[model samples]
Target: MKARAVARVLGKHVVMIVLMMFWLSVLVFCLSRMAPGDPLQSFYGDAVQSMSTGELEAARHRLGLDAPLWVQYEKWLSGVAQGDFGMSLKYKRPALEVAGPLIGNTLILGGAAYALVFALAIGMALICVRYEDSWIDRTLCAAGTVAFYTPAFWLGTMLVLVFSVNLHWLPGSGAYRPGMAGDVADRMRHLVLPLVVMVASHVWYYACMIRNRLLDEVRRDYVLLARSKGLGRRRVLMRHCLRNVLPGIVSLMAISVPHVLSGTYVAETVFNYPGIGLLSVSSAKYHDYNMLMLMVMLAGFLVIVSSILAQAVNEIIDSRMKGAERGGV
Candidate 1:
């Protein structure tokens, strides 16, 4: 029975992933192809006029710009099937090679930032639920709203100013020192500011979510009955109340996964971090179409995968709880 539940969830995720990939591919193809000026011509600049007609044709052929859109797309799809995104027209290297490291960096930063956020947010939410609208709860909620609306870039700047520029407590920017003795320490230092910026901007969002869920759960019949049974608040909250709250948490987590993936572009680019967002901007400026396509597609894929994972978790949890109740043993 457990195996069947797992299989069902996995099947749904697979279907969703396929749909997401298709949508992403279509978007990538249309947007770049529709952009003003031919990419081949854009790559050559004014020198296009200076080139002999034969030279121009050679350049077009070399880049497969001469192929019809359908044909080009077909070729691209074939390469994609083989796990090749093709070579970058501008970077002059395999598109995947350039994007792989940067994607890893962005994921690392985003994962760490969100992990801290989930922990802090849940902790704060529990506190607020325990306190239930005291000065501290109201104050933090007020401050959190202000922080949530502030642009990530501005918040990041202030953090750098306070922690790095003024106090000299943290490095202002960059991933790590080139000749750092150990990668682990250097990475931890690099993560500090960006993660702080991420936490500052978004922690409130999750805190509010978890807080609202907590408040609602405590008011429900199960919780009230649990309280009547003389169970401590912590026990009710930790064991019983949270069982209901967690699905919402998982759903929200999944919903934000895409946002988390996309948001990295904003935070990383703002801080000059070595992530796909920064590299993506560079690729766009260079008309590195191949790299840009890969980046966009990859971001989309991650989002789809996140949603799928969320759905699976939901199904599994629901199935298990229902099963337990049915057994009544």
Candidate 2:
């Protein structure tokens, strides 16, 4: 019976993801087709301008762009169903092939930043909770608000100018120094500025949420009881309040995936980092339909999956949610 319930839950989530992806694909396809730009420019570069009308038609036919919009969508959908994403018009390569390494780079950058942002947020929240209404908490709150509102591009540019251009302390762009690709330390040095921008832009938002939650937890009856039992303030906060609040924190992190991912993309573009974020910008600018379609689909899928997984985790962690799910089932 338990196994059956788990299977049912899994099946429901799979169906939800499939439906979401289908609609997302439809939306992306229609929008990309309707957007202004000559895809031929992406494919043929400056030569597209020199092509005669007849030659241009021939080129379009060769690339299957001469087909009607619905017909093209049908062809593209069928190809996607079979795990073929088609060729990238700009690179003249298989879309996945071109994006594969970049995806790994993005995962590395994004994954690290995601983990660090949460860690720092939680740590800062703890410090604020410890200090409560003291000057430290007030100072952090002010700094965080300013950092949260700072434009990521402007922050990135300033960091580059100061650290890379003036101090010569860190390399501003790219995933690694060209020949030092195998060195983890070299890669980390390149990661520093982008990571700083991502962390600075995101850490405070979550920190504030955590601080509020922790403060709320501190006032609960159980905390008062714990304090009455001669438990130290730090012990009660850590052992009781923090533990109780962790499940909500998990849910918050799951909800934050899309937000953090968007910040990652912005950081990537600013740094010229060879990641899916940079690829996304270039693909959109060049009207590389196949590449754009793949990136959009990948992003949408991740967002949907993360939300589903967060709900599942919530169900597992909170008995109230589990009971609710079972009753609904």
Give me the candidate number with maximum lDDT. 2
| TM-score of model 1 (CA atoms) | 0.87
For model 2, the superposed segments whose C-alpha errors exceed 4 Å read 318-329
* Model 2 C-alpha lDDT per residue in residues 231-269, reported as the tens digit of each score: 999998888889989989999999899999999899999
**Cα misplacement distance, residue 156 of candidate 1 (Å):** 1.6
Q: Give the lDDT of residue 236 in candidate 1.
A: 88
- Number of backbone clashes in candidate 2: 0
Q: lDDT by residue for model 1 over 184-230, one digit each (tens)?
A: 78888888888877887888988998999899989999888888989
Q: Tell me each candidate's TM-score.
A: 0.87, 0.96
